[model samples]
Target: MKKVLVVILVAFIILQFFPIDKTNPAPTPGMDFLTIKKTPPETAEMIRTSCYDCHSNETAYPWYSNFAPASWFLKNHINEGRKHLNFSTFATYEPKRQLHKLEECIEMVGKKEMPLESYFVGHQDAKLTDEQRKLLIDYFKREKAETERKMSF
Candidate 1:
């Protein structure tokens, strides 16, 4: 039993050597939501503080992400967040897709479902207040309207 325990510990140590990819890609010019939309400074700041880490190409990886299993989990979250809605690549999407994304953004904000709890754990700044939630929902709703208008033309 002691020998089996030793092997398990060794295996766990070996796993630590294999690190996960935690790369943050560079932002594309004029393709990001902030660049394409005339977002208010306050709104933009809030979004950056709360949502950018997972949803944009400008992730500021925390020191804890350097470890093995934690880094793997974080990378998975980043990939999933980007897959759902990448603000950095928002403008590159089709007009219809942009509109749909904006709608989803508004819905998610209104539901207080964004900036997932795990993300908010280490990032207290990412936790939205009632007003911040309203702010995001309102902004996304307005953007959705603008997208619809543009698509109609």
Candidate 2:
């Protein structure tokens, strides 16, 4: 048991050497969804608190992100989230893609699948209340409608 414990401790220490890259991409405010869409302040704040960490270039890494295995998982998760939807570069996406992404936002928030449960473990403040979810859903719906309207012209 003692040997096993020693080995585990050593392995854990070794893992710390492989830190995840914490460099976030540079901000592009002109192209950001919040800026381009002119999202309401309240709704934008909610989105920033809950969604921006993973979904935007402005990731604010938490303390745990300094650790290894957890950091690796977090980096992978953030990369995947950005791949799916990068709000920092929202205006760069084609109009149809933007509309589709807004639709996705409505679906994800309405279904309460966003701000993943694991995220809440580290970020309690990021948790959305029922009212906040409704607000986000409504905001996304409105954005989608606006996008569609612009696409028609």
What is candidate 2's lDDT per residue for 68-98, written digit by digit as tens?
A: 8999999999999999999999999999999
Q: Report the Cα lDDT for residue 112, model 1.
A: 81
Tens digits of per-residue lDDT, candidate 1, 1-153, equal 999999988987887898987667876959989878978899999999998898899989998788777888888888888898899998889998998888888888788888787787799989999988988898888888888898888
Any idea what lDDT model 2 has?
Answer: 0.94
Structure candidate 2, residue pairs in collision? none
> Which stretches of model 2 miss by more than 4 angstroms?
none
The local lDDT score (0 to 100) that residue 77 gets in candidate 2 is: 98
All models: lDDT? 0.87, 0.94
Cand. 1 TM to true fold: 0.92
Model 2, C-alpha of 93: deviation from truth (Å): 0.6
Best by lDDT: 2
